[model samples]
Target: MKDKLKKLIIIPAYNESECIEKTIENIQKNAKDFDYIIINDCSTDNTREICERNGFHIINLPVNLGIGGAVQTGYIYGIRCGYDMAVQVDGDGQHDAAFLQKMAECLEETGADMVIGSRFIEKQGFQSTGARRIGIRFFTWLIRLMTGKTVTDPTSGLRMVNRKVMAKFAKDYPKDYPEPETAVTVLHCGMKIKEIPVVMKERAGGVSSISMQKSVYYMVKVSMAIIIERMRRRK
Candidate 1:
């Protein structure tokens, strides 16, 4: 199954000119058999230029759609190309590609619809700041309340999905609070999800979209979004 699986690494990049190259290079080194595409989310910097110069497979978005929209584009692209599985890895150099193959194997062996690389599972390597972990814990409790699934890292961008969930996400995915919201969506759809411990690196460059000032807003907004998604789950 591993030998026959066609996998795609969906990297959603925005203004990651400094880290995008390194991200791709890591994938090339670790998951060489798997193909990858950079969803260039209309970065103001020369991200597209760097990708083009390196001759990487890239889909240039006309406008900035944030993480959700950019990731959805990769799902749509993967479905059209007939990939067996796809994983979302942030282009900011925070997510390491070394764990990608492990996630893929976990998906196949466990027959899970989604597999997440979780930093909190082992509590090793660049665990996000304390304030961020508090927010993460809140979402973890919220997700468990809504779907009975305990996700140690609901905010993690490192996730792999099979073709079925890939198609669903391509059609309908949230623009905000996507990770937690989509976890609820998947659980409500009767799909299985698994998590593997992974150590994430600190961002090599570029400011995070979520700032200290925005943390409160992020928590409140995502909590509301998770509740709404739970209510909207398919019956």
Candidate 2:
């Protein structure tokens, strides 16, 4: 018989000690049906220690690799471990673990390569900041222009990917502001991507890694990066 539980929840963490424990606990409570792995990205805080204490499967990077690298690491591990599906959840406590089952079911039922947990699809929670919201919308338009599909939430961290997507992302993952670029990359590779409504909450503790200045920088850099990636792929 085939494995019934073939999904792995991959949490990319960095200095998330304040919320890591709660995040894991919530996932344990809400997504007990799935296995969990936390990729501790060289957190200066006690993120790794807490993960170990809580008996979570962990992969510790020697240095901080940001969200993209940390998540890619999990994807590489997931593919290596032979998991049929992998889900990315933030350790900052914003992502809703309760949506895991819905996203996973969508992934399996629709045979989509990726299913993103979108906060904007149904407009059911505290939305992002004004500037960040504009940036997200711009990126969504860019993705649609390039991929010919309108993605409601281009930067949502809550997402589920199949083994095929894991393999592709493992081989070539983006570095900065990955979510938008990654969606385009997946579409470029002829993979189907879908979005499901998911309500998100404010982070539980500590400040966001991306500040106002960083958000501005991210918007500029990612805009240029996406255009460059498209040009390179066309060549």
Q: Give all TM-scores, in the order shown.
A: 0.97, 0.95
Q: How does candidate 1 fare on TM-score? A: 0.97
Q: For model 1, how does the per-residue alpha-carbon lDDT over 83-192 read when each residue is reduced to its tens digit?
A: 99999989989998899889988999999999999999779999999988888898899989999889889999899999999999999998855898888789988999
lDDT (0 to 1) per candidate: 0.91, 0.87
lDDT tens readout by residue for model 2, 1-235: 2248588898988889899888988998998888888899898888888888878789999988988898899888888888989999889899989999999889888989999999997898868889779888999898878768899899888889999999998988887678888888888778899899999998888678788879878888877777787887889
Identify the leading candidate in terms of TM-score.
1
Per the 3 Å backbone cut-off, how many clashing residue pairs does candidate 1 have? 0
Per candidate, the number of residue pairs that clash is: 0, 0
Return the top candidate by lDDT: 1
Q: What local lDDT does model 1 show for residue 128?
A: 91
